[model samples]
Target chain A: MVSTVTTSLADVASSNAALRAFLHGLPGVDRVGADQRAAMLGTRSIKTTAKAQAIDLAISMVDLTTLEGADTPGKVRAMSTKAMHPGEGAPRVAAVCVYPDLVHVAVETLKGSGVKVASVSTAFPSGRSSLEVKVSDTALAVAAGADEIDMVIDRGAFLSGDYLKVYEEIVAVKAACGDAHLKVILETGELATYDNVRRASWLAMIAGGDFIKTSTGKVQPAATLPVTLIMLEAVRDFRATTGTQIGVKPAGGIRTTKDAIKMLVLVNETVGDDWLSPDWFRLGASTLLNDLLMQRQKLTTGRYAGPDYFTLD
Target chain B: MTRLSVRKTYKLYIGGAFPRSESGRSYVVASSKGEFVANAARASRKDARDAVSAARKAFAGWSGATPYNRGQILYRVAEMLEGRRAQFAEEIGGGKKAAAEQVDAAVDRLVWYAGWSDKIASVHGSANPVAGPYFNLSTPEPSGVVAVVAPSDPFLGLISVIAPVIVTGNTCVVVCSSPMAAITFGEVLATSDLPGGVVNLLTGFQKELVPGLAAHMDVNGLDLTGVDDPELALKAEQDAAENLKRVIRPVAEDWTAEPGLERMTRFLETKTVWHPVGI
Candidate 1:
């Protein structure tokens, strides 16, 4: 959590040019090595004593998310309440993620619970809108008392080699976020390569993203082990170079306790123990919470609870 | 070089693919006369858990399949079994006459069950003569994933217990004792049109796998036909109660005898529906 280099909005262009040089000049990743490392870490046998602790840690690091056009005030409220108390003996989730329109409902429901409300903005899932509108989206969510703003990077610009444009948009959104923490979503599925993922990780970090995220949970191949592994290496190297550690969130397709535990293992080995907490690592999933709760109950009490026993919120 | 014999490695079948036991353990198998057969994968509790997961995943598509399609798939399994008759007969390891008879019975049993798939519902379902002005009906539905311990009669007994459970659209994980016969049978299932996970066969000790399968929350039923030890069978029954799994206790019976509706009905859950006459 040390500060090394600061890239301000006034210096975004020159900083982006220099940042591009740094990120591109960064050593190219060998895909086979990254996958092999992830596979080996996945095989690490987390036994009874450690499994119980790992399940709870995974629970606390979850950002219980529901982002859909069908979202409603009641749905947001119920999910937020579930976020506060997942089950008996279960700890509160790190945050409740919702669309900008329902941020107020989540904010009100999570009041006094110490669970932050995260709103997804900037034309989310698809950042095809103008900068003015995207900034306003962040502004509205922040004004509505969102403690965190999850923004989507302009992949179109990034893919077209307009790294500076993507960097400046993030800078503008960061300015709009004001006091709220900013999470930049790379939607690595669309980025198409491990190299692009590494470059996007650096772009977000240099532009002041508090956390570099893997997906928006709306595309196929959203989050994968190899992709997340490459991102963890990016954040780990970023901290070593800049002296500041940024968080990593892998959203989508992670639905079981085993999947969550493997992610924790990846973070533990790749970035070391410092990134294992909710402050540094997160799983953007909803169904995964119930699995963790079920596993936790199994560890505490020697019986498995049926789906009917847990609330479906 | 004198003829190089390609000795086969016997393994467990889960999710339609052959894989070694997750525990990397294997046990030696031999004939009743103590003749060396082969080293078969001795599946562990972890393997049982994996098979249960595979069965659960395959349940929806399997149970949702049309009865006609299921029947066709079961019939296709019989056709494949017929083609591999010599292999099964040799694996069962008796004199030619007895082995051929056992293989024939197994194939015929599959065909019989295949025909029953489309007819069992019609024979079991009833429209009640209720006292009120309402339409009340009861129909049988597949009871989700089932766990089976294949019977002692390696070939015919294995077919008898498995056919009835899956014929009703239920997916199952079977723990067979006879490694040679079970693996050979697994080859037939793989070649058959039956879906990959519809009938997972694990070659290992029933004592090792039965407890894990019985206790698995995802498994909805238990068919302990292969478990001969009364004490072990009782323990599995107790473990199954954790999830209130439908229990099918093992019984002493001749595999070649006429099978009853009891095996079919035991694994079916009768769902009753009521509707007003006006509607």
Candidate 2:
């Protein structure tokens, strides 16, 4: 994936000051334009045959997530089972995201199904732990057979203008994740601005994250369209400059098939077809899968499906 | 300077909100003399789908409500209807006295059903004499969401069909033939203590809406009283079998007559409970 321009961007990581200069020198986001563009792209009405395809694509791109403190092994197993077979002939979800402790349960349940197990680590939802603890947390999930590690960024450090602290933590966690893919959760709700989301997206990609995620699903306003749009642009720009493509996962607030389709629209319009696959884009939601399944049933059966028919998570 | 008259557009009531039909279509609702009265929102099958969803969402809360509480809310709806008598009579478009009588009958019919909220269960339920060391009791339970087709009798027919469904703790999605009065009845329901989605009124043709509701798996019951067409009613009843929905057959009715316990019991399921004696 390395391009000739890789060395020029890699030099910025040599120092904290260089990284800050590059992140800050990137053009500031016009908040209004980003909002307007996201809203405009959202208005595209995908209907009939196109809608059916989009529903299946969105289902495949779902990282069926359960990040609650009360998530148990049984719950994880059930969720994993649902993730692998949402409905008859429906595409399996891209991954199943759980708290770090339940990684093995999901891994065991999803064996031979090809659905990746993603564990949120780094004292997830709030990256307030020491780097030693965070690295071990990633290592624990990796050892438990998690294929992906979703580590939260140090919001306290990032908010305090310590970009290097956040960058180094992501790097340490990435190193701990052996062969597993790394998804850096920005917790954009805490970041407070679009430019910061863009900067955090770049920082995670530069720090060797395989995917740049919007949130840990524990925060409010976890993933908004505009924030995701900004992240998509950052990934697009990163691939252009460094020739390395980073996946985008917008976790949390997306709870409906319509919201899932809107996220797809944002991806399709923002970075075009290259980022539309499950490998590049994922919706980190728990309830979104059932809605997609219901919609898929509606499309195939020509009637609306009830929540009663689908098993509750 | 003269002020512009604000025209009242008839809209659908779903989940307690007055929304224009998603289809963005309206039909000319005319008086008995065939003159156009107003344009009523012509709800499509999608609207039926939305109304069923709303009714389903409201089912848990409405059905869980105490029978006495439901009675109070139904009584409150009757009170609201009483106050709106003149508006409903004018909307129904008959002689003032006759229209007013129809509105009064609807109000009285609602009150009658409201009184049955706490008593209907007792009337329909029974204690079985089982030859075991246990007490076996059979009581009626609200059968989830109901989809109803209201008769063309603008006020009395609609109210008679709806009040019984809701008073029994069942939420309903209703397709009413008289658009103006149905939407206006929505206003009365909104002003009452009754919850928004407890009774969703869709102003559209029954032929267009019944099939969708019948096919809706979430809807537990269907009242086909308003569907005058035998073919449409048969098709809906057949489709309702997809989920084994309890269906009430179409029947001509005199709204002013005393209503039997049948309307209240039609959409109710008999839940039998067996308990050890003295436990």
Best by TM-score: 2
Residues A1-313, candidate 1: write the lDDT tens digits. Answer: 2133334323435855765665576577788898898898888888798998999899999999999888889999899999999989888999999999899999899999989999999999899999999999999999999999999999999998889899889999999999999999999999988889998998898889999999999998987899999999989977876688999999998999999999999998889999989998989998999889988987777554555567786
Off by over 4 Å in 2: A1-7
Compose the digit string of candidate 1's lDDT tens values, residues B8-115.
999999999999999999999988899887999999887887787788888889999999899999999999999988888888987888999999999999999999
Q: List residue ranges in candidate 1 displaced over 4 A.
A: A1-16, A303-313
What is the lDDT for B239 in model 2?
Answer: 91
> Lowest-scoring 10 consecutive residues by lDDT in candidate 1 chain A?
A1-10
Clashing pairs in model 1?
none
lDDT of 1 at B59: 89
Consecutive 10-residue window with the lowest summed lDDT within model 1 chain B: B207-216
* TM-score for each model: 0.93, 0.97
- Candidate 1: lDDT of A109? 92
